[model samples]
Target: MRRALGVVALGVLVTGCVGPRPAAPVATAIVAPPAWRTALGPGSPVRAEWWNAFGDPVLTRLVAEALANNPDLGIAAGRVDEARAAERLARAQLSPTVSVGVPTTDSRALNAFGTASTNLTATPSITASYDPDLFGRLRNASAAARAQLLASEGARDVVRLAIASSVASGYITLRALDARLAVARDTLAARGDALRIARRRAETGYTSNLELHQAEGEYRATEQLIPQAQLAITRQEDALSLLLGATPRAIGRGAALTALVLPPIPDGLPADLLRRRPDLFQAEQTLVAADRSLDSARAALLPNIALTGSAGVILTTALANPVGIFSLGGSVLSPLFDGGRLRANVDLTVARRDQAAFSYRRSALTAFREVDDSLAGVQRSGEQAVAIRGQRDAYAAALRNASNRYRAGYSSYLDQLDTQRGLLTAELALVQANADRLTSYVALYQAMGGGWTEADVAAVRR
Candidate 1:
């Protein structure tokens, strides 16, 4: 009857050891529009070399260089490695651990026959211990670690996309600044010619001293712009140099903004963004980790079954005898009470998992917003650039007509001054508009997660 009661108790304990497993977290489906409202180019598959869409070899080179050398990218890659190592460690926990120890002892003692004896004994033993994952604790912990590694990989790709876009955008800005500087220098030359013409007209009685003074003032004003434009060019160059991990210095020139070709706008489905955007993917991985953590926490509340065993040979010199020893045992530990700490851990993980779900939802919405914003920016900026180019051309013609009319005494010097200022303003605006359009394209590519791939991630790890 006592044996029967013990058997019943053991059966109850084993039943409790199974506990309850946490269910996987389910993600809510988010609906996206079938098509973008913005008038962007047709959507297409992502290219691995998205920067090459600009058709600027210089930009392509710069982006590649930044990917290979940017310090922020390196840091992200390091984090990926760290996460991978953590995953490996978690996996190792699922396997049993075996260790060998060799112990030697020298002693002076009396033997069984009452004779004094010096004896040396050496015993080498191998021991192994394994904790069975009775409630899937090891499995849950490993899954959580793997999700963390995936999140790290996604983070690294996020950094890669940012660095590539930034490098391309910086290069575009530098080139635009160079174009503006050229415009400033050219305007200064034109102003000098106008001043010379005014002086000649004044000497010949074709114009008054007031007009000559106005021309001189215009020339000095245009001259001041040259230094400012040069300063901007220097500043842009410095920014690009840092992206390349190089000393602050001049960068190689790329094709003019007008010479670069724009790729067709991709009209990718909104739902596709979940697959393309690294940040969203990272958030999802974080959610997975949270879910797994909750499972591991729940599993921790159950009893753990562990098996320990050892085997070795012992030699006694005094007795001239060799003896073998072996033992095997199993133990079960169930958490009876810990002042509610176990339940608190469960609550903590549940709260964390809920937070992760909210974070994942927020990230998805943010991704959608970014894609929409980039699409609008690209479309509107492209339209603005075209309109600004036409305006610049019209202003240039007006400047010429004003100069001609002044030469013929048909218009006042004030008219010529106003046209010259308008032409300068229009030219500068056109340059800026073009650069903005190009940068908008870069932004769109980045918002779409560029051309990052698992292969690229593997390369980064290496």
Candidate 2:
């Protein structure tokens, strides 16, 4: 009865058995506009498989393969599973633990009357113990674990988006290399024909040796490009192989550079965009977990309460054959002095929570910046491609006119050479511009967080 009174007195001292409660974190208020500052084209919302915008079957297949086979994504998936297991462990703490045990022994002893006696004894017992969550410590820990699990899942989605975008960009570059290689070979063939004409003119005494030598130099210069381009193609194929987690092998071809088109995209509000990105979700979940951890740390300052009980039976070959025993008890442990460990823990949690909040805000700002930068890249690359195309056409016309004048002995060989070089340079630039435009589209899609979604993860889990 005195112990019971002590418990009541302590409860009264600790605010009626609940102790002090920590305040919940306030909601962060964010304002976003209706649309992005960058100019947007007319289109529908981006689909989960945004790579389909390219309309290339080969590209679509490559992206699918990368997503299925990439090791980084596999690692992220494993982290999700690990976090889920931790959550289960935290939740298990809320339940009581009960165990049963049985022990048996045979004993031979001499009694006080000088008679030897043998007896068999058995004792069976059941023990149970439970820690009540009077101060919400267990509940907060479980909540924090749940938040960590969600954060891991979001991190997996972030990896998925990166893999998809990388596959698309690599595929575009490989195709561009193929187009550029074709241009180089065609130029080499044209140079061969011009070299033969120059040799014929020199043999007939119509052109000097200097002109013939210049023609030979130009022909060899163009010839060297074919081997250089082939090397680039090999290296690009190797890079793409690594992305797909495959060995260095021949990469498949896709649509020609000229046949490709940039898919349209609609610029949604910043708030909606933020919701779509997995990285942002990850940051937010991390902050939630940090807040819960802070709550748990504060709860540690209160008292810990537990209840214990046990029941047993004893049996023996004697007059008082069987016996039963039962007992019950409770405990309360309050923190009086701990060298300031509890206060240090609380301070540490607060610091971590503040860091998470800052990280979340930074992620939001970076996401918006990525979207804007990609938008600008797409627009500028498209304009550059158009200008380069016009320049290539004019160079082609000039080459034709220069060749005609040279055949009629009206202009020098230098005119034809200059025009030919200009045309080749313009063509190569156009190919690069096309590649840049396609990759910019890829970046925009990734920034918009249109690749994978929660459904994809659920399917994988199932």
How do the residues 386-439 of candidate 1 rate in per-residue lDDT, one tens digit apiece? 888898899889888988988788989899899889889989998898888888
Q: How accurate is candidate 1 locally (lDDT)?
A: 0.77
What lDDT would each prediction earn against the true structure? 0.77, 0.79
Checking candidate 1 for backbone clashes, the offending pairs are 41-265, 42-266, 42-267, 43-266, 43-267
Candidate with maximal lDDT: 2
The segments of candidate 2 whose C-alpha lies over 4 angstroms from its true place after superposition are 1-47, 104-108, 267-271, 319-321, 451-462
RMSD of every prediction? 17.8, 17.8
Backbone N/Cα/C clashes per model: 5, 0
For residue 31, model 1's alpha carbon misses the true position, in angstroms, by 40
Off by over 4 Å in 1: 1-47, 110-115, 204-206, 267-270, 451-462
What are the TM-scores, per candidate, against the unseen true structure?
0.84, 0.84
